[model samples]
Target: MLTIDTCSSADVDRLLGLADQFLDDWAEDAVQGGKPDEDYEQRSTEWKVIRPLLVSAPTMFKGLKEIARIRQSSSDPVAICCAALARTALDGFLIAEGT
Candidate 1:
């Protein structure tokens, strides 16, 4: 996997693992007692850092939705689109930060 400057490999792995689990649970309802696991809790907490950004740049909301769609795909076409969306989202985030 391509590495980002801001995130360590461990972070990437944890995020991907959590996402994969969520996807699986979504399809089969494997989560016991219908309760979220620790991974889900961690992912939700991580959102707190960026939730403010979302409030500032409502336009990024669509980009985030597109990112979720992109995340589910394993196709080459989707990979290309994912790269574009990543750039757009990053740019939108930077702009929102006045950077």
Candidate 2:
């Protein structure tokens, strides 16, 4: 697994933004059981942070009709996946950014 000596505030902040973006889109979709918009790229910085969240979000919200499910649940496999992805991002972002 990739690992980093430290995580930057920018990276962490971007990660949080990514997380929030997903939540916002998901909330919009939940309002009427509609699907989310899909105009985003797979290679952008937001996408880099949002990718893992998008990939695992379904599993994170499965069998639940409301976003409250996420708040009420104590354990979720998606959380584990996100944790792993966050670690990988911290370690790999430098390489990914060619720094």
Candidate No. with top lDDT: 1
Error of 1 at 51 (Å): 22
Across residues 1-97, which tens digit of lDDT does each residue of candidate 1 receive? 4223244445555666665676566545436648756665565566656545434443444456567567666567767687677767777656865
Q: What is the C-alpha lDDT of each candidate?
A: 0.58, 0.50
Extract clashing residue pairs from model 2.
Answer: none
- Those runs of model 2 whose alpha carbons end farther than 4 Å from true positions after fitting are 1-3, 34-99
Task: Please list the Cα RMSD from the true structure of every candidate, rounded to 1 decimal place.
Answer: 14.2, 15.3
TM-score of 2: 0.30
Work out the TM-score per prediction. Answer: 0.27, 0.30
Per-residue lDDT tens digits for candidate 2, residues 1-99, read 222324444455666687768866755655564553454332234656766764553344332323333434535777555555555554454586456
- Lowest summed lDDT across 10 adjacent residues in model 1 is found at 1-10
Q: Give candidate 1's error at residue 95 in angstroms.
A: 3.5
